[model samples]
Target: MKFLPVGYNTQDLEKQAKNKWRWQWLSECDSKGMKWTDWLKKIDVCGVAYCTFCGKTINYKSNGKKALKLHCEDGNHQKIANVVKTNSVSSILAI
Candidate 1:
């Protein structure tokens, strides 16, 4: 009897590829109500939206903005936000 090689499933590979594509598409297209603030930026990885500043990830399918807001409200994110705001103000004053 001859058997196929172990761990060689074409269907699984195809499914993974399809899912990756779908996630990429969703990340590119799904950005409603997401503000482009210095404290956070939308980054999609494997179908999840993440805050670049705070390193927080959220499901794009479930209220990504809310998660971002929460992160921004956190103490660490707040500190970064304050620093960014201060720098902007300083630059504007220098100009």
Candidate 2:
């Protein structure tokens, strides 16, 4: 039982291409036009959001439960996280 960290490099770059479908999953989300709140929970899709102190992946659950705090691994998300919490992500200005 092993779970790879959000980002790992031990895998050979070429053969590991098997998992390169992340972008395609994201593209699928784009094509569906689902709400960000809904799409964020679709599983198999992860993301990276950064600010001064946060360099970690987001944590979300089904039915819109969220605790996207910036922890030791996901630290400085105060500002950006606030923006998302306050409104639909689509309403935000491009950053």
Candidate 3:
């Protein structure tokens, strides 16, 4: 027996198209109405995003912006965001 991957299914491929990642997502505000552009960036890979704050990679594949939203709400991400904010402020003040 053989199993087909989601990419091989026509309907799944169509769904992937509908859920494709958009560069605009990085500029859009999160559910909390906070912009994450300073930490979020597009990966060269077809449907992947990178979070510089936590050094995390997010694969949107068929989930699109929902994946990004979840990443923003993740506890670890929030923790890292605070750390980044503190570090930047201290570094600036040191100058």
**Largest TM-score belongs to which candidate?**
3
Clashing pairs in 3: none
Candidate 3 residue runs with Cα over 4 Å from true position? 1-18, 31-33, 93-95
Query: Which ten contiguous residues of candidate 3 have the minimum total lDDT?
Result: 1-10
Question: How does model 2 score by TM-score?
Answer: 0.22
| lDDT string, candidate 1, 2-95, tens digits | 2223233334333423222122222231133323343333332333445555666544334434444455566776665556556877868889
Candidate order by lDDT, decreasing, is: 3, 1, 2
lDDT of 3 at 42: 63
lDDT of 1: 0.42
When 1 and 3 are scored with TM-score, the better candidate is: 3
Off by over 4 Å in 1: 1-36, 55-63, 89-95
Best by lDDT: 3
Question: Compared with the true structure, what per-residue lDDT tens digits does model 2 show for residues 1-95?
Answer: 13333344423432323233122222322222332332222223332322222333443322112232213222233444454556756666654
Can you give the TM-score per candidate against the true fold? 0.41, 0.22, 0.68
Residue ranges of candidate 2 with Cα displaced over 4 Å? 1-14, 30-54, 57-95
